[model samples]
Target: MKKFPEHFLWGAATSAPQSEGHGSLNGKSPSTWDKWYEINPEKFQKNQGPEHTSNMYENYIEDAKRMNDIHMNSFRTSIAWTRLLPDGKTINPEAVTFYRNYFHELHSNGVKPIINLFHFDMPWWLMEKGGWESRESVDAFAFYAETCFELFGDLVEYWTTFNEPMVHVECGYLYGYHYPAIHDLKKAVQVAFHTIMAHTMAVKAFKAGKYSGKIGIILNVSPCYPKSHSTEDLRAAELADLLNTKSFLDPAVLGIFPQKLIECLADNQLLPKVEVQDLHLIQMNPVDFIGMNYYQPRRVQAPATVNHPAVSPADFYEHYDWPDKKINPYRGWEIYPEALYDVAMMIKDQYNNIPWFVSENGMGVADEERFMDQTGMIQDDYRIEFMIEHLQQLHKGIEAGSNCFGYHTWTFVDCWSWLNGYNNRYGFYRLDLENDQRTLKKSGIWFKELIDRNGLL
Candidate 1:
């Protein structure tokens, strides 16, 4: 049998936009997602929009109970910037009251709340202000962080500044997927730089206020594995890791950017405009810790051609599709549990063993109703196996001396995913979209036992 550390945090992660509905209610301003869905409904699958999600805004009381029932000690969710400041600057009294009550409910039910400040749900007003491409938005985000710390600082002990910010850079600026979609290398680099600057600014504010709680950032730290041991392959993998993984991790954890990454940008003429003291601020405001969201490993090979009309990461490396790779057919993600151990060791060996945790890991299955039994509960045995396999690897890393403290699944309930909506379900409790009902799935029952034992046998 293997066991995690005492006081191990066992919970699931959710986001404000994905789980909390009431997009426009209670004096809430429109978020980028709301406006994007309104303008381009056809872009979303099944014409689903962000108007009505899992309704967590109204069902938080019972949702907290569900978390406690499963012995989940810590849960991570974001505070909607749109809700907190409806107009992007003025505080909304109604939103403050609602969030106050929701955090109180979690505490009353014996679940500790881990509140994240931003989860890519930018306020519509902020978006119109040039979003991350402008430094003024960075100041706005720092102000938002300070406001959150003051408003709910007493309620939350664990605070995160941003969640998977790289996604915002890639999906919105590089790829045409997320809201405010644009494909420009210059904008992408600028967005990445401003995003990190925003994080450091938030960290500076958090430290300056002398908040009792710890503040950090959540990054999707997917390790890049080379297809072969050849020099070209290894170099390609390193570049991929530099661009995708360490670009944010180094700045947040180590208070510096990778020199190689800087050189890459300089050589390509894609360097973002930087202020004279921006690097100093980043160097001074390292996070207290970090949250890592690992779902798949990136396999890369040296690109055959480096010629391009404009600078792009694709010119440096190409994705290598390994034959016979175990994959999650539903989500189209590779299922490589060993990558968990690799990520843990990377943090231990390369990043001075910073305090971190698995913030998001789960299996998303499509049309989960097919697994429901006669009792109307989802028999998600696959999810159980997935977590167990990943946990086993994580336990190995812990025993070998990784400063990991927790393991949070991707979600607690079936929340609405971006574009995909609720088609891919990843939750311990199945949420009935029709009636806003939540039923504990088989994985939830198994997880309770695992939490009680504090180990796997």
Candidate 2:
């Protein structure tokens, strides 16, 4: 077993809307998710919504203790925008107290808290006004960022401006999976541009406040691979990469949009409206670090026919199923551990080897209870194997001088997903939703030992 660095962050990552239940309770307000679920409950699998998740809002202290028991020296979690600024303007005092105390408890327990400002749960009021499509939404997010730095910045040392910004843009605007569902290519481009601008503004705010913390953004980066050596397949893969990876990566890290991507968008009349000053802000306010969420690599093949200019990104390329590829049976995602190593190499060669971490990486399973053993604990050997293989690849990346720093799995406890809800479980600890009880799965125990030894065993 290879040992990780002494300071390597070992913990779990979770979002507020998915984990912290008690929606709109204790002076909180509705997020876009809450409103969406209310309007169309059928959109969520098993009809599970954010109203009552894992109860993390009230059970954070106990949860922090559980995290400590697992030898988690660090944790990454997001704050609910609606809970903090219910009206998108006024600060909720109760939410402030809750977060301050919750973070204090984590700190007191020898656990470092990595906080994120946005995690796809925009305040309902903000979403009602066009969400990320309007410039006003950018300013609103800046104000919220400033307030967070003032209130809880002291408790957090590592702050993230946004978590998976592309997911919100693609899912909500292009694919119509999330709230305020719209399938216009232009709106999607506009939303994505505004999101990047908001991130830059927030980064500026965090630096101007001079808080003793480092701020960055989290991106889900899945490098695109061509199915064959043909020119069409290569072009298709490059386009897929531009849409999936470089769209946010170049702006965030390089502070400039890729010329090819810009040309493509302009040719299609899908270019986002941008101001000269906005470009300056983006170029000047680059992130101090990056958090990467890796799930799987995308394999692309050339479409049979070129689509119209107004086609959504999803329609721009055809996804290829690699022949005889291993798969995650439950999630239907290709299991390619080597993609992590490829991502690390790409970062090293193209992105100046910036400091980064695997912010979210884990497998989800359906009907996980069927794996429980006689001892009343889930004997999730599959999860353990998954982690080991991925970690081995990550270790190789570090050996190759990739500057990778940490590895945080998808979640700490079983919680609600956005569209999938609790249908798929991806957690170190199992949460009995019916009883509101928490139990350690075998994978959780394995993680504790791994952390204690600071390596795989």
Candidate 3:
């Protein structure tokens, strides 16, 4: 087994809304997720909402102890916007004290905290005011970012401006799977534009204030592979890449939108309205690093029949399931471990080999309790295999000069998902919702060994 770099980060990743319960406690206001669940509880699996999950809000000290028990040196999590600034304008003192204490606890346990500013839990007030689609919301987010830097910047050395901004745009605007579910291409373009602009401004603010840490954004980058060698298939794959990856990647790393994407947006009259200085801001503030969340590759082919111009992104290309490919039956996503290597190589060749890490990569299984043995532990050997294969590919990327640094799985403990609720569990520690007891899964114990050895066995 190959050893990871001595300084490679070994930890688990989680988000606030997903892990932290007590949705409306201690000066915490409702976020978009809270509002969405209230209005459409049926949309969530088992009609569960974010009101309670892992109870990290009250048990973070114990959680930090568990993280240390696993020999984790770093942990990635997000602070809820509503928790920090309930109205998106004023800072909540109670929330601030809670976060300060929580982060301090992590540091006391020798765990480095990588905090994200936004993780799709937008303040409900902001959503009512047009959210990221409005320029005003962008400015508000910049203010919120600056405040976070001033407050918790001393405790956290790694800060991410946004976690999977593209997912929010695509799921919320294009596919209508999230809150304010609107299916408008024009709105999607505008939302994406503003979201990136917000990231740009946040990065600029972080640098200008001389914050004591590095700042970056998390992108879920899935390499697109054409189904065939034909020009039509290639074009379809390129379009898919443009929409899914480059739309955010080009701006964050290259500091400019791809010319092809710009031309396409112009052709469709879907170009977002931009201020004269917005481009300058984006170009001036490229991120110091990037965080990639890779799950699967996109297999695309040219559409058999062109849809009308009014069609959504789904109409732009046809997705084909590759024959003979391994699939995660529980999540319905292809299990292509080699795609990690491809993504890393793409970054090396195109993005100047900026320092990056796998911010998220894991498999979620439904009805995970069925895998639990009589020992009262989840015998998730399948998850162990998943992690080993993915890490092996990541090791190959590192050896091939990818400049990758770390790999954090999707979650540390079982928690609430936005729409899926508790249907899919992706956790090292299994949370017993009935009793709020957390027990280490077999994969968690294996991860501890892997980290202690600094390599796979």
Candidate 4:
């Protein structure tokens, strides 16, 4: 039998914007998500916006009790910037009180809280001032992060500056899939740069404040695989890794950007305007650890023809669909359990074996009601098998000396997904949208057994 290390953190992750309803109540200002939903309700599935989420704001005490029942030792969630600092400067007392109560409840329930400062839910006020595109917004974010540390540092031990920061730049700036939808490559590069600046600044603030906690960033490090052994295909995969994986991973871990990525941006004249001091600050403040969120591997091949002026990541490499690839039919994402092992080894070999954890990993299925048994419990055996396969690979990585300390699924309960809304559910607890109630699925029960045993045979 394989055994996990002692004191491994077991839990799930959710963000405030996705799980907390009441967008504009309790002195909270609107975030970009709220404003976007108001303007384009049809963009979200079933027209379900961010208004009627899982209602965690009102049910956090019960939710924490549920987490205790599942034997979860830790949980990750983000603080809504708009909720804490409505206008980006003034503090909201009601928001602070609610968060303190929530964190205290979790602690009382034997669960540790891993607090993330930002999770793509940019404040609408900051967006009005050019969001992350402007240096002003970056400084404001650092201030907000410092405030969070000051307020909750006594209760929390782990802090993350941002959650998957690159996704916002890519989806919102380059791909038009998220809020502030625009297809501007120049703005995307600028947003990515300022985001790293904001993160390092926050890390600097944390150290200056002398907080007693480990600060880090969460990255979705999907390994890039070449479609074939040809030189062109290998080069394509390399570029994909530079853009998607190392773009943020390098700076957070090594306190610098990859040289090749810098050259690529400079050659294409897509480099953002920079101040010398910002680069110095980035070089000085490296994170203490990182969180790795992996779902699928990126399979890439050389593009048929590179654009005369490269405008997007796709200009260099195009996605390659692997033959006979296993997939999650409901979410349309390829299922590759081996990728977990690859991600683990990559962090060990290339990142100096930095301390990290599986921050988000799970399968999202649509309409889980069909799988409910007569007793009203969901017999989600498929989710159990998925977890087993991935955990086996993670165990192999740990045996090979990856410095991973924990595993966290995508979510604790069924909550709002960005544009997909509640179309796909990725949770151990089934949430009734009609009424704010949660019930554990079979996978949740199996996970408790895994936690009790500390491993699998």
**Total clashing residue pairs per candidate?**
0, 0, 0, 0
Q: Assess candidate 2 and give its TM-score to the true structure.
A: 0.98
**TM-score to true structure, per model:** 0.99, 0.98, 0.98, 0.99
Which segments of candidate 2 are over 4 A away from where they belong?
none
Tell me each candidate's RMSD, in Å, in order: 0.9, 1.0, 1.0, 0.8
| Tens-place lDDT digits, model 1, residues 1-457 | 7988999999999999999999889899999999999999999989878878999998999999999999999999999999998877899999999999999999999899999998989888989989989888888999998999999999999999989999999999888888789888789989999999989998999899999989899999888989999999999999899999889999988889999999888878888999999999999999888899989989999998885434667888999999969999998999999999998999899889989999999999999999999999999999999999999999999999999999999889999998999999999989888899999999999999999989988
lDDT of each: 0.92, 0.89, 0.91, 0.92
On residues 1-457, what C-alpha lDDT tens digit does candidate 3 reach at each position?
A: 7889888999989999988898988889998889988888888888888989789998999999999999898999999889888887788999888899999999988899999989898788888889888888888989999999999988999999999998889889988888888888899999999999999999999999999989999999999999998999999899999988999999999999999998878877788999999999999999988999998889999988875553677666889889989999878999999999999899999999999999999999989989989999999999999999999999999889999989999889988888888888999999888878999999999999999899976
* Model 2 steric clash total: 0
Off by over 4 Å in 4: none
Indicate the worst ten consecutive residues by lDDT in candidate 3: 307-316
**Model 2, 131: alpha-carbon shift in Å?**
0.9
Cα shift from native, residue 128, model 2 (Å): 1.6
Residue 99 of model 2: what lDDT?
92
Expressed as tens digits, the lDDT of each residue in 1-457 for candidate 2 is: 7988889999999988888898969888988889889999999998998999999888898999999999998899999888988887888999999899989989987889999999999888877788898989889999999999999987999999999998998888877888888788899899999999999999999888898979889999888888898998898899999887899989889999999999999889898989879988988988888999988889989887776784766556788999879999889999899999999998899999999999999999989999998988998899899999999999998999999889999889998999898888999899998977898999999999999999875
